[model samples]
Target: MSQPDQAPDQAPDQAFDVIISGGGLVGLTLALALDQGGLKIAVIDRLAAEAVLEESFDGRAAAIGFAAYRMMETLGIAQHLGEVQPIEHILVSDGRIGTPGRQGGPSALTLHFDHRETGSGTEPLGWMIENRRNRLALDIQVATRPGITRFTQDEILDIQVEPGAVRAKLKSGTKITAPLLVGAEGRGSFVRKKAGIRTYGWGYDQTAIVTTVAMEQPHGGVAHEYFLPTGPFAILPLTGNRANIVWSEKTSRAKALLSLSPAALEAELARRFGDFLGKVTLDAPVWSWPLSLELAATWAKPRITLAGDAAHGIHPIAGQGLNLGLKDVAALAETLVEAKALGQDLGDLTVLERYAQWRRTDTMTLAISCDAFVRLFSNDIGPIRALRTLGLGLVDALGPARRFFASHAGGDVGDLPRLLRGESLSPALN
Candidate 1:
């Protein structure tokens, strides 16, 4: 039951070291990270804090990569995340609905990514936590830090990035100024648009149907990515016998499936869900959204920068969206914290470009790979299917290749910031 530090009606003119628009996962994370580094922050969101905690607010769950999970542990938020399921194993295969495998249903060849391969042997590849649970943890953690001032149930009406400062006027008539303004809002970010930063991407022909399912048997902490003719159907384990379903299909097919009765939809899910997890039934409401691939033209514009979905939106074929954003948070927080230690201007483009350059190549590489995966697997073509199936077998058979892919999925690839490496940022200021 964390409360906003400032009530919208009682909010007065104030200034902070940073002002972040959109108090979603990425934004709140940045606020917490900066606050931990001794910087005051203002977090503004359109929805009330309680609304964000509601199950109906967001039905999706995010796969927290091991590296990102370590970051959270360092931030003091991990201990508060209740009821999360670790991803002990991952099985990726290609097949259409009801297709039979060598010993069972699904494809014969599969690429397996085991947690043991990460060199820790006992550490999980990642953790699957509901979006609401994650928000709750972030809300509680933000409340513990007096450096953060959260402005909920409000919108930013105007923004002006002048010399040395960025000023924001909220719809509630509250004004706040900061050296840097960050847009962690989703794909359609007002801050980014207001900054006149253009984006490049196209809407995918697919839509993702997200919901929770109760399996008769336990999921054994295993995650499955089944590639069908339509798209990738992900079965991510949760606490108990429940699993999160992220089913992607053609826009038209998803619309029709969503229009069906609860029982009817369950029947359709069973066709692809298989019996490996035993009988499966819908345990939660169904939610779907059209998929797309979008990347901002630039991440930094004097006094302003973008993070998370505001900067890049990729297909969920791989669950790297939030992990990618968390990386951005780590990078940006480190850059700002170190700059402040050196008495450098946080809003300077030269200072912000450091964050942008560190994330650009990594973000683009993952985005392109996800798009490629969707195109390669979401087809029933003859030669392409055979080649891809063979590719899966090849990757699985190679020891180094399998371990490499496993590490990549765990967010262990690339130049990691201190937080991502499970280290405090204080040393960076040294």
Candidate 2:
């Protein structure tokens, strides 16, 4: 083992089947998924193991969709998750406080989604896992995952590409050469920029304030999304009487609200958080994120590709960011595993294009739909508000339509990959 912040104990001129930039949750998941194809993989991350293992990781939570949960199980890490909260029911409502005709009675124009709506009566629609717990699981999963090498606290300084191979040089004087390179980094991917992929999108005038809250009453395993005029405020149930809060507001207001004292912040929270959950108080540091929409013009290059937030970033109104990345994991894993089994070069542009083609339409459709959702719900216009409320009501009244929406949001209603369907990646294993 290498010392802290040092290169791994391997040959200086190590080679791998795939070299991945970024050791984040998405990146680690991708590495594990590709390893199932019997391909050697190397992960380069600047964060130290200690930082990744810390108990307070960004103080955030991820909503693992039903399909995403299955993918996690296939990667051999789901059972290791310390604890997770089940979201058996989801409620969507329009009109936040200060909006016209908004009385804040529970939630106005509400739409409820039941887990049975997905036709899986025994399973939850989704699970809420803490970011810290997920990262810890990834650390252990990567350590146990075969065909993969982890380079912690090491940065990829430069990359030299050729038709046959790509060589990545690290700051610690270690060099790795591979035919396939992936950028699972976040939106500002160093590999994506090096591969000459351009991104286009704009930041919303809104910002999301995230934190966990402890409630006086149980959450009943329900998630709530209250569409405020400024943005959406969500209370996602956590392991106990605690729930994760993602309150979106105008950038200016969020800034002011974040500056409030603990008492003032709790007061503001109660204003948006209804009494349904009883008293609510902040249980963690309040964090805010600027909402935005950005997508890579293309998902792949000669011998390089991107996944997760590196490829697309959408508004969090739907809480599908991580789910989208998990979908990428499933699709890319399926693509690479299928290609390797056929004796095709996994790095071949044609082979990589298959992955891109598989994801292109679905990703864009999600981005556009999320953007439209934000646009529609963020408006305070009376007629538009009434129309959206009626729309929610219609869906609520229509059982089939409600179920369709439920399954779609649960991420079990689309063209799924083998991993997401709980199938083996390697045909021999099957």
Candidate 3:
């Protein structure tokens, strides 16, 4: 890592309320959430703001849950995100050739979830947003907030936990102190490592190839998932008749497939995607990410805590990675703010413990659920495939079960954080 630029006036003795490493989505959102509390916050990142958005599309997008959408609204950043596309329905199906002996006669089972059925009214279950857009909105919000200080082109060289504060040394020879330190640095977080925290998880032997495609027909704001033997192939609705595709395949095969010509790649995609959307053409550069399931052994200790991918990384089969991180920002912010009101040290063990306890169960549950779904559906075993198809059929036949899943997808599960519950942390921006 390169050295950070030094601040001429050093105030190591003066402490900030929080020092967050890695100014990605989670870190920036957390900073905004704490901005209203009259606390001093400093966010450090290695990359400059402009460098983060140099690429268009970048083959990455996030499925922002309804609750997260509301949280963004409370943060006064949602409206700034360009071209929000709602996903009104989600369709899941198993794409496997069945024998004639099957009871359903080789018909593919479809499980559909509609947001309107759950009294969400006209509101969407979630919005599909390009990752860069979300980051840009966050950067703008952070820049406009009065109490937040942002440090770009800065890298953390070392961290030390003192009796009353956590001190961080930047490579630029500048030092900062804060009562609480948050790690939002992503999967391979340097902050988590400096704090001596350990994680337990394994990588799946799969690589996810992501890109955008222009389809003959409009997506109609529907998200489609096809469970093939290799992995799950998802087509998320985008603005203007375009769909974002995330196709997970075996590692070796993914490398070879990625090497194919654009025409060859489009041909393979159309073959697997079928003609439901008519002929599809590649519209963006392809990007690939390895699949993994990672969980930190502990979320908080002393004045240190972890959030977002820094704490837990799960399968994208459910598109809940960013949603989960947003939840973390909400929970941790709430805990600290409420603690301050009650005259408790924001970094007190009891206060941090509360935040950890609030998030542990939900994070683990989602991780296990996604992992299980990926494993159960990503195999071509005859008996297992039959069981899964039957299960989907049963879910489709049941109304209450379908609604339950829909509610979960709409981000209505668990003890929601205040922002996610549609309560404003600060006054709405005009």
TM-score of each: 0.95, 0.95, 0.93
Kindly report the root-mean-square deviation of model 2 from the true structure over all alpha carbons. 3.1
Q: TM-score for candidate 3, please give it.
A: 0.93
Deviation (Å) of 296 in candidate 3: 0.3
Clashing pairs in 3: 4-172
User: Candidate 3 residues 1-430, lDDT tens each?
Assistant: 9778556445344468899998988999999888865567999998888888866535688889888888899888897897789998888888753334332111356888877544365678799998888889998888888799887999888889888789888866678888889999999999888888999999889999999899997779999888888898888998888988999999999999999999999988876776667889998899999999999999988889999999999989989999999999999988887787687877778899999999999888889999999999999988998899999989988988987777676677778889887675552321
Tens digits of per-residue lDDT for model 1, 368-394:
999999889999999999999999999
Runs of candidate 1 with Cα error greater than 4 angstroms are 1-12, 100-105, 427-430
Evaluated at residue 268, the lDDT of candidate 1 is 90
Could you tell me which 10 consecutive residues in candidate 2 have the lowest summed lDDT? 98-107
| TM-score between candidate 2 and the true structure | 0.95
Deviating ranges (above 4 Å) for candidate 3: 1-14, 97-108, 117-121, 427-430
User: What are the candidates' C-alpha RMSDs?
Assistant: 3.7, 3.1, 4.2
Q: What is the lDDT of residue 214 in candidate 1?
A: 96
Clashing pairs in 2: none
Clashing pairs in 1: none
Give Cα-based local distance difference scores for all models. 0.90, 0.86, 0.85
Indicate the worst ten consecutive residues by lDDT in candidate 3.
97-106
